[model samples]
Target: NATFGMGAISITSEREKDVDFTLGVMTTGVNLLISKPKIMDSIFQFMEPFSLNLWMAIVGASVGVSILYFVLDYPSEERKFSARETWWFSVGTLLMRGTDFAPRPSSQRILTAGFLFFVLITVSSYTANMAAFLTTNNLEKQIQSLEELVERSDFQCGTVKDSATMNFFKTSSKPIYRKVWSKMSEGGLVSGSKEGRERVRAGGYAFIFDYMINSYSELTSCETKMVGTPFRLQEHGIAMKQGASIKSILNINLLKIKESPIMTQLQTKWWENKRKCDFIESQPTVEFGIKHMAGVFIVGAGGLVCAILFFLSKKWFVAVRTKEKSAESDTGLEETLYTTDKTMSKEDIANAVKV
Candidate 1:
């Protein structure tokens, strides 16, 4: 017999029992590759970027700020703004329309600024987020996890027949892997790794292959990606039959290469080719939570508080001035009465005093 040992041989427990293997040179794992499809959305697709709570917040903020504006402007002497006018002003501002009836009160101004700032942030982020979702094609739903893949009836999977990947699925004690193997029995078994990849490329098929190739394939095909995390982590080594004399020699040389700087250089030669592809995964479709826009919310709340404070202070100042004027008028009237009493008799003073 001839020595049949080289790279690309997956080192596994079953294989190790029959043959000795050299130190692993390449590390890889099994993963599923599926084609990306365009997902159709409802008429309200524009709302996908932000959560429902966020939409409600936007509406609540707008209505709440407008009502507050009316409350502050109702009693103002400087502006003759009605409830209808105030509401229309708020709507115009939110819609990015120009309006001449800007609030004159200091507090109303602060509230408006805050509302405008929130609108600016929301509109800009919404535009960017919507664009990313539309372009990324992440809206297309497929089996995103192993459990989902197992339950998926529309998609089928397979691996290279009699290959290490196939063996792993076949011998795995995990119910999940066993179920996968059972499905493969129905069809999707390919003669070679290349054939398996081809079936995956045809669409509606998931191919169990090396994650290294999975990654490279994603780079070349922008519409494809790994369904879930890579499973069955393993290594490729020189596989040899039992009692091979060159085992020691092969192990020593492979270990040396693995430890030395040449390993890095060699890996670069294989993976770092002068090529690139467009990527959409991990780009958009990521949900924007409240924390992302906390600053905007904070600014708006601060403005609202400041506005309320200014409104209260203005009312207090006006009250104080009115009280002082009333007191001065009473004093003046009393002095005039006293002068009348001095100039006229008790009878004339009685008529003026009106007991």
Candidate 2:
């Protein structure tokens, strides 16, 4: 109830809070007079704060650190393991010989590592992009770059929800970040409605905040160009459970992927294609393409990889079964003829059976 009251007061307060020392002392004194336990007292002697605010500050810092580590660093599914469960499992593994405590044994580790690596790579690429953008002087234009953006003010820039783009806002803010959760929502791009992607493409908003490669892929199908330069960039690589043994394989795969010609070709195909963005306001198709190209590539690649793997595995199993049946048939003719015949000798049966 007290917390609720404080929250209500905070939300309803007309003025911004200025935490002066006088106000703090007055509040602490009033609480003491009201039969409240002295804020300075601590159950644990070592944990005691020098002052009430000092205690509060420590608590606040702990909460903030926890949020950043558990929430911001990874997806929710990874954090679903409870504190008690994680602790016991970890302790048991360290105590018990030949124990692997990791929840993700194989594929999950690979996927997580790959995802993080990709994110790191994207960040680095964006950083380089930002540096290049800053290097090329543009003194003549005031609102020349996508980096100089504001929400519902200048240009509408968007990102995918629960993505690194959302995390980017916590540290960097060169553009207004809007989240489009789905392909359909992205296609619509509604401003002030979480549909910023669709709106940006349609000229209801301007520019998108995404990885350079993603933007490049999108440009292949869309008219909206990745103008000016990248606002932010950092290393985006795969994530693992702090330390995992598959580091060598993960690193190798990442290096191979980066060096591949496929990625280069994809970049060219998307960026080199010319389209009329000036006429984007007139064409619904053009607008849709611009907003939705990035979304399509991501979804399509994920689906395609899954499909190919499934088909190949199915084909391999079929071939193995077919070969096994052929081998069994070849060895069975003599046995079949002898087993059925009561009057024939084994040699006669062997002679009589077809080769």
Q: What is the TM-score of each candidate against the true structure?
A: 0.53, 0.27
| Alpha carbon deviation, residue 217, candidate 1 (Å) | 14
The worst-scoring run of ten residues by lDDT in candidate 2 lies at 25-34
Instruction: State the lDDT of candidate 2 residue by residue for 1-355, as single tens digits.
Output: 1111111011111122321011110000000000111122225523221233433433343333223223222333433534444444433432332234444423223323333333343334434533543343222233334334331243334444444444444344432332222211333232332244345445534434444433433444343434445544333333333334555565666567666776567546655554323312111110112132334335433543443454455567768999998768755976777778867887786666544
- List RMSD in Å for every model shown: 11.9, 32.8
Model 1 steric clash total: 0
* Candidate 1: tens digits of C-alpha lDDT, residues 207-295: 88888777777766655777788888888888778888888998888888878989788656665562265544443365566777778
**Which runs of model 2 end up more than 4 angstroms from their true locations?**
1-143, 146-148, 151-154, 172-196, 240-242, 256-355
